[model samples]
Target: MNSIFKRTYSYWFLLPAAIIYFIIFILPTIMSFFFSMTRWTLSDWEFIGFENFITFFQEQSLSIGFKNTLIYAVVTCTLKVALGLLLGVLLTSKIRTKSYLRSVIFFPTLVSTIAVGIAFSMMMHPTQGVINTALAAIGIDGPDWLGDTRIALLSVAMVDVWKGLGFATVIYIAGILSIPAEYYEALQIDGGNSWHKFWNIIVPLSRPATNSVIILAFIGGLRSFDLVWAMTKGGPGFTTDLIASIIYKQYQGGFYGLATAGNVILFLVVTALAFPLYTYLNRKEVDL
Candidate 1:
């Protein structure tokens, strides 16, 4: 009994954290579920069943928001994974000023999201912005980056990648450095080239880190709001309208219950997509 008590007693230390999580996250989520079904104000709420859900779906921006959200998530995740892996490999190699370069790469991530968004918004301006000014100086007519509906979401996705690339790189760097040196040495003895070392060892062993980056980047992309809001506010006519922005629009128009339903839907969409992705990625990791 004493031994069992000692073994289980360590779990008691988690009580405070668990309680906090319940209060902060779990409780609010449960309340949101209820509130989403009601027409409510600060004073009172009347349950109107799933009318909010129906109304939310009936919004003109629903399709646009849904499509843009998926595209944003997929594009950002793919770019972050590819670019981050490449940068990580390069940084982990024997290169001069690697530490300084790493710091420079990560510096953007330390800045405020809104600040980055605002700064980039101006930099990407077609006529007055530095980007086009430099382009014109070199005899190239720059396109309107943010104003062009065709590439507006892509532009934002690129900015999101820039902000997040460092984090992904750092993760991959750690993963690469954690690999045992003997594996490489053995491969060298077997006449393995850099390609063999990379394909056989680095790629397989880096699965854990790659998986973490994918899951985190994907989830962050799905929930992306502030940067998008700060940059374009889903502007250029719903080109970058994400689910979160749609929800905010609803709230702006005094559709509290409907907004709550949108929030619920966003949560559900993220949960549904993220879980399957995580599971599949984990399976890959295990298989590797």
Candidate 2:
């Protein structure tokens, strides 16, 4: 009995969390799968089989939204990894104001995403925005940032990078700081320059942080809705119609079943992309 209790006691500790996870996540998720297959009106649900899924694919905006989702994820993930690594390296180096700068750089991450979107939307206004006004002062006419279909998605992506860069930097900063000082000392003793030390030490050793940032930023880009909706609302003629945004438009139009189907598709797509990428990154980490 004593031995059994010892083993069973640990299970009790997990019970609360397991229950919460089921009630909050698993339950809703299961219901969503069911809801996706029906034409639901709260009181009545008509079985529709795969009609919702088929209709979702038949949406005119589906193609554009899918393309935008991939583009946004790739662009944002790339920027976060590259810029964050550089910022982390700089911040980790010897500098008098490094602490102050770190806080300043990270300040943006603390702001609400929706608020950031609204603020940037105003600043990106073509005629009277602060960005254009500043450009005008320099005798350069700033193009319509949010209104131009060609640059709309790209513009939103840049804002996303700026918003997320700080978190990535902090991750890299922590990773770099974790390295033993002895490694740097050894490199210096061997007459190695800063470049060699960074290339040989920081880059390789920071792989774990890089992996985390890529996975996180990519997932975030794939699921991003609030900022994009708040800013462009998939505007400039469906050019920025990410999967999430398209689903939202369906929800607003009262096509709950179709929207749920879209949600299901997004869940599958994110899982498919993320799992392989995560496995690949982990394998690389193990190899290193």
Candidate 3:
């Protein structure tokens, strides 16, 4: 009876969370599949077979959105991993102002993203913005940031990396801290310098954290909407339009079914890529 009671209690402990997950995640996802096959509005929906998906793929904006989304995800994820690792090493180093510098670097992640977007928009303003103003002072011209199609996506991506790098750095710090100090002490005993310690000890032991950061950042970049929308609205002739932005525009235009289909596609793309990549990374981690 005591054993039975313990099992019951364990199940009860999990009940609330399981129910919440079903209600919030599983239910909505299942419903989305249904909605993706129908034309829907607030009060009404009608079955439309695969028409929504067909239209979504054929839409001109979607083509650009797909391309931009992939590019943005790849670029931002790479920079965040590379730069975050660098910053993590710096913060963990025995340097003056290390604690203060870590806080300063992390402050941007705590601020409101929309506020960051707006502030950066103004800062990158061609004529009077601080970035261009500095360039002008150096006798160089700054390109129109969000206004120019060529660089608008890259500009948004840079902001994303800035906003997210701190979180990645924190993750790396945790990973690095978890490493046994004996490893570093041994390296020191071997007369290894800082660069040698980093290359041989820190990099090898931090694989798990790197994998986590890469997957999370890549997924976030793929689904990014708010900052891009606030900064460019996928504008300057659809140059910066990501998949999420395109879906949002469709929803705004009352193409409910098509928007649902777009969401479905986004879900599939993220899941498909993320799962395989996660498995590969975990395998590599085990090998490490």
Candidate 4:
């Protein structure tokens, strides 16, 4: 009886957090699922089955949004992983200004996302922006960064990568630094070059960090909104439309239920993709 009481007392400490999580996350998620199946106003809703989802799929820009989301996720994840790994390796090396450089690289991450977006939006202006002005000085006419349909999505994606690269690098740095020195010493004794050591030891051993960066960046890219919105807002005739932006457009058009359905879809996409990738990465980590 006493042991059971003690366990119960211990669980009581978790009640506050549990209740908060249920209220904030679980309750809202459950309500979203229900609302997605209904035609809703702020005050009332009518049961409409899966009409919202059907309408969302029937949206003309759905295909574009879906494709852009996948592309953005892939490109950002690849860049972040590759660049983060390289930066982590260099920063961890015996460099004189490594500390200062690390701070400089990570500084942008501390800035607000919206602020970054707005600033870059201005900087990327065709004629008046700093980027084009500099290019003009070098006798080149710079294309409009955010105005071009062809590269607008890619432009916004590059900004996202720039903002996120620091975080990925920091993660990789931690992972790289955590590696025991004995491994490197062993490689040295075996007369292994930097390339050999990096491939055989550092790369394989840092799988966990790499996996973390990949999943995070990929998910972030898929659900990207604020940066895209601040820069392009799915502009140039929906050329830069992403899933999140499409959902927001539904809300802006007063299709609350439809937007909710889109949210549910986004949730499912994240869960489905993240779960399998996480599982695969975990297995790889274990194998390593």
Candidate 5:
């Protein structure tokens, strides 16, 4: 009777969260799958199996969006991991004003992303922006940052790294701090320098944190829309259009079914890539 009562109480505690998840996630997912197979408007939907997917793949911009999203995810993830680890090591060192510097670096992450995008758009203006002004002072010409098709996507990606690296650094700091100090002491006793300590100890022990940062940042990059939209609006000839931006454009143009199909594809891509990478990284963590 006691065991039965405990089991009943445990289920009661889980019921609310289960219901909420179903309502928020599962229901929308099911509806999206249904809608993806139809031509949907506000009040009417017609069954059109696989047409949306076919159209999506046939679109020129969709291919560009997929390619850009893959590149953005890979580049941003690599830079964030590399730069964040460097920043973590520096900030965790016995340098003065380290905490103040950390706060300053992290301040951008707390600001609204749209606001950041707008502000950066202005700053990157070729003629009147502060970046160009500073470049002029140094006798260097700054290219049209967001307006130039050649460099627009990369410019936006750099901003993303700047905004997100602080959080990644903080996660690294936490991971590094949680490691036992004795390892460093032992390394020092054996005459290991900073390079040896970092490569041999810090990197190995921080694998879990690095894994988390990579997955989160990669997903964020893959789904990035707001900043790219506000900054470039997928403009200068679709050079900066990511998959999320393309999907948003579809929705805005009243292609609800097509947009739904894109969303489902994005979901599946993230899940498929993230799960395998996550499992592989976790296994590496255990090995380490």
Candidate 6:
């Protein structure tokens, strides 16, 4: 009985944090669920069943939002995994300026998302932007990055990769560095070259890092809003409309219930996609 009491007291240390979690996250989520089913103002709410949800789905740009959200998540996640691994391996190798290079690569990540978006938006301008100006100097015409319907999402995805690659590379670096030195030494004794070392050891062992990068990048891409808003506001005819952005637009239009419904849908969608993905990736990690 005394031991159990001691253990209970030990667990009490988590009470404050748990209470904070309940108030900050659990409470708001519950409120969102409730408010999502209502037509509400500051003073009162009228329950409307699932009408808000139905109207949310009936939105003209919902399809585009879903499409763009998926594409953005997939593209950014893939690029971050591949490019990050490549950079990680390179940076982990014997190089004099490795520390400086690592810092340089990570610099963009430390910048504000909105700032990066705004800066890139200006840089990607069709005519006078630095990117286009440099392209013209090289006798190439750069397309309108943010204004184009087709490539706008891709452009934003690329910027996301640029911003996120550093964190992914850092994860990979930690994974690679954690590998036993004897593994490389044994491979060398077995007449294994650098490619063998990387392929047999680094790629396989670093998969945990890859999985982390994929999951984080995918979720972040799905929830991406500020950058898109700052850059194009889901413009160019919904080319880069993401679920989060659509919710913001709804809120902006003063349809609070509809917006909340969209938020709930987004939460459900992310939960649906993320859990399966996480489970599958973790299973792969275990298999590996």
Output the number of the lDDT-best candidate: 2
Name every residue pair that clashes in candidate 2: none
Q: 37 in model 3: Cα distance from truth in Å?
A: 1.9
- In terms of lDDT, the poorest run of 10 residues in model 4 is 279-288
lDDT of each: 0.91, 0.92, 0.90, 0.90, 0.90, 0.89
* Model 3 steric clash pairs: none
Give the C-alpha miss distance for residue 31 in model 6, angstroms.
2.9
TM-score for each predicted model, relative to the true structure: 0.91, 0.93, 0.93, 0.93, 0.95, 0.93
Q: lDDT of model 3 at residue 274?
A: 90
Let me know the TM-score candidate 1 reaches against the reference structure. Answer: 0.91
Between candidates 5 and 6, name the one with more favorable TM-score.
Answer: 5
TM-score of 2: 0.93
Candidate 2: misplaced stretches above 4 Å? 1-10, 286-288
Give RMSD (Å) of candidate 5 vs. truth. Answer: 1.6
* Clashes per candidate, residues 3 or more apart or on different chains: 0, 0, 0, 0, 0, 0
**lDDT (0-100) at residue 2 of candidate 2?**
92
Off by over 4 Å in 1: 1-16, 286-288
Candidate 4 or 1, higher lDDT? 1
Residue-level lDDT of model 5, residues 90-118, one tens digit each, is 98999999999899989989999999999
Question: Higher-TM-score candidate among 2 and 5?
Answer: 5
Per-residue lDDT for 149-267 in model 3, tens only? Answer: 88999999999999998899999998888888998899989999989998999998999999999999999999999999888888888999988988899999998888888899899
The sequence of per-residue lDDT tens digits that candidate 1 reaches over residues 1-288 is 998898888778988999999999999899999999999774789999999887766766765888899999999999999999889889999999899989999998899999999999999998999989999999999989999999999999999999999999999999999888988899989999988988898888999999999999999999999999999999988888899998899789887887888889889989999999999988878433
Score residue 90 of candidate 3 by CA lDDT.
87
